[model samples]
Target: MDKYAIIKIGSTQYKIHEGDTLTVDNQNGKVDAEVLLFSDGKTTILGDPTVKDAHVKIKITGAVRGEKIVVGRFKSKSRYRKGRGYRDTLSELLIEKIELGGKKATEEKSIDEAPKKAVEAKPIKAEKKVSKKEPAKKVVKIKKPVKKGTK
Candidate 1:
């Protein structure tokens, strides 16, 4: 099947296929930039902006200035005029691949490589020596000397 993808070149949307080199106003990076987006026929939405789960990729070609256009402002009666350069910055894209659903960001680990066993949390017990601790105070005992005469 002749699969065509809709991708955003820069500020504009473009319908392109493999090995197609396209230009846009400006892109995120220079030539051979890594980009990924979802593509079909109806729309080529910005995956990052709308759907974070979307998958798409692209490569940058080069950055160049477009044709300069003269912009003039003139008043018919007052005779006032001004001119300015209008060379727009643009970038090129070499459509690498369009992932319709999303990029295979990750893969499931094999059954043999199960998740690491969680650390067995033991109850924290302060191991203080009770026998070494001394009592707060010592008590003294006094006895009366009447035991000898009472018998």
Candidate 2:
């Protein structure tokens, strides 16, 4: 059972655990932030503003730039228009560990687990077979025929 924590980095808060990777607004290099809350399914600890000596350890794995967002402005009857694009810089962080009062919550797990293989279904046998000779056409019979008589 691993403990999880909600921590604040800059202005944003994120729920994280050991070995969890997250993307946050641009940060240079590694960072350590205080935990706001901690829980391990059964037991929970809440911090007054922030927990004492509880922190999340993180390191910047990579820098990411978000897709460019286009903005446009238009005015009616004035022939006015404006266009702009914006891209935000983001930081990719790997949560190294979470500690509370000098005790580690979870151990780093290795990425050596085998991948699941998809089960192959057996092929179905074909029911109808093709033949060179033309088959006979099916004819539906009428139950009763009307007799032609002089009215």
Q: Which numbered prediction scores highest in lDDT against the true structure?
A: 2
Q: Candidate 1 lDDT, tens digit per residue, 1-151?
A: 5546544433455666777888776765643222344445566555454445443355777888899999989999998998887898888767766555544323225568867898999999999877776768968789877756564
| lDDT values, one for every candidate | 0.60, 0.83
> Candidate 2 on 1-151: residue-level lDDT in tens?
7889999988899999889999888887646576899887778899998988676768789999988999999999999999999999999999887776764333334589787899999999989977788889999987897889997
Candidate 1 regions with alpha-carbon error over 4 angstroms = 9-11, 30-54, 77-79, 101-151
Work out the TM-score per prediction.
Answer: 0.47, 0.61
RMSD vs true structure, all candidates: 21.6, 18.5
Off by over 4 Å in 2: 30-32, 103-151
CA shift of 26, model 1, Å: 1.1
Best by TM-score: 2
- Taking all chains together, the TM-score of candidate 2 against the true structure is 0.61
